[model samples]
Target: MEQLLASDALSDSGKIMLGGAVVGLIFGYCAQQSRFCLRSACIEFWGGQLGPKLAVWLAVFGTALLATQALLANGGLNPQDVRQLATVGSLSGAIVGGLLFGVGMILARGCASRLLVLSATGNARALIAGLVVTVAAQASLSGVLSPLREALNRLWVVGPSTRDMAQHLPDGTGLALGVGCVALAGALAWRNRVAVRTTATAAGVGLAVGLGWAFTAALSRVSFEPVTVGSVTFTGPSADTLMALIVRPDVVPSFGIGLVPGVFAGSLAATLVHREFRLQGFDAGTGTVRYLVGAVLMGFGGMAAGGCAVGAGVTGGSVLSLTAWVALLSMWIGAGAAGLLLERAEAIGRRETAQL
Candidate 1:
């Protein structure tokens, strides 16, 4: 385990990634079973119903911040080089990206991670989203959208690794900060869960996500290759995983299940345990055009802004990356807009049906 985090060996990185994949598997299974999703909670939870699934996400964000900070402070990893810090802030990317993502998720009926896990359970909608995202992501990553995304990246003020505070902060402070934030997020989540009376379930959900991330971080540190303690996020990694599947299938598996495969694996594992996996994506009732349009936004926005809500919201948020904060906050605005619109549409339809 100690050898896993060593900078001297590439094998360590692979070990860390493998460990991460295991943690991800657990996360996927647990998440699938629990149906944990911030957006789902936010979008689906009604008054006097389930509480916002914010805790699971908050736990992930909080833990990612604290643990990664501790690792960097202790000289276990280089925060500067981590992709989280490498991003150049892009307001347009974050906002436009988020709005597009928010809309797409609504139409697709889930976010990227949700799509992955759900697809495994036989939800064809998710499978469609996954396929569309992969193609759009490729375009955004290295195709027609590449130049546009680069232009946006260059537009931002490249901070001197404000993304690397864990490296600068004392190990103790960073550790306490990391642990404390998780604690804070936990408290808030607990209060919400209790309020909603889903205490037991929420705790389990939050625990699975937090522990999964922590486990991965520990594994990444001990593994040989370049490792950074991290957890779930669906934007870049999902895209990379998708592209890699086609381009470099043999490239060493790093930290987590690459996006394309992980979605199926995690969802399948969930389905088998629960016996709920079924193929779901062909509804003529819901416009495919609407879904595809939304997906395009997610891919382009994810690339331009550096991540989607899951990537920025949960994963990057875990690191407390300022940019992640920007992205998440922006996403809420977009999500709220879309959610509100959907609510209005539903209300109008109900009224019309009543009159008829």
Candidate 2:
């Protein structure tokens, strides 16, 4: 039953389970404390007065860049062949998908990444979002929507896989580009340095996360049951993880396969130890409608865009995929649109109410 779970060093299945546990614990603990939420970063920076959100995101962006580049240069591992980070540049899909997801996130009170963090804190609405995300994600992967997704992807397919984009550039050039991007991110974070240390810490934690996944990915190849691996994001991965938990028991949880549950467990444990586990309940109002509707849109957008910001932007982008870059840009643009739309809706509603 546990045959495929062994660590790469030894084909011993027990080691696999142990490896997963250790990785998962670290991931969960840091994520919880740091409150790493990609959606929150975008939304808060744009809508709220939170300055650290961008800093936190940029810090991780830089760290992942330096680490991934160094790893590849030193012959650590190749990120492209991993199917989890497929490179398919569809500009329209990303912008459109991100807009839908962004609006959904606004309604749900979080993006895919934020949902996970909030869920760890016991938010009921997040739990609902998670449930919908998982079911719908599965449907996209292999259920009802799988065929359609595949068909559309093929139809709109414009370029090589994301991983292949990295190959187009020299290693040094790639490394430099990543570093420059991170520097820019660091500059952004500098402004908020005195404000949200938690957000800054989040950046470091996100790096740890990227490394953890990379190792798990490498181990999967040399280990007993090889598993495809990439950065763990809450949106699509939430649904994917749920499906894995249900099926992997009769099946097997590979090294990379186990990290996600580890992420949630990590967060849960942090909540418990820190005495921060808070029960959450949702209110019945337009808020409810917003969350539900947003969740559905997020589900569709996450699938359509291929992954969330953390998934497509950070993980896939690190490898220097053109598709990832395109997706990332498109997402931010869409998110901008969502922000404007929300403002307009509010203004219109207030006007109508005042007239009444």
The lDDT values for all models are 0.62, 0.64
Tens-place lDDT digits, model 2, residues 237-323: 566567666776653544444555666677888888889988878766547777777777777777766777666677666766565
**Top lDDT hit:** 2
Model 2, position 253: C-alpha lDDT score: 43
What is candidate 2's CA lDDT for residue 217? 56
Clash list (residue pairs), candidate 2: 28-266, 28-267, 87-161, 87-162, 104-294, 134-239
lDDT of 2: 0.64
Q: Give the TM-score of candidate 2.
A: 0.83
Point to the candidate with the largest TM-score: 2
Local lDDT at 291 for model 1:
71
Worst 10 residues of 2 by lDDT: 1-10
lDDT of 2 at 203: 57
Task: For each candidate, give its TM-score against the true structure.
Answer: 0.77, 0.83
Cα lDDT tens digits, model 1, 110-219, are 77777777777877767787778767877988898889877766665446466534445554664576577567656766666534333333344334444445555565
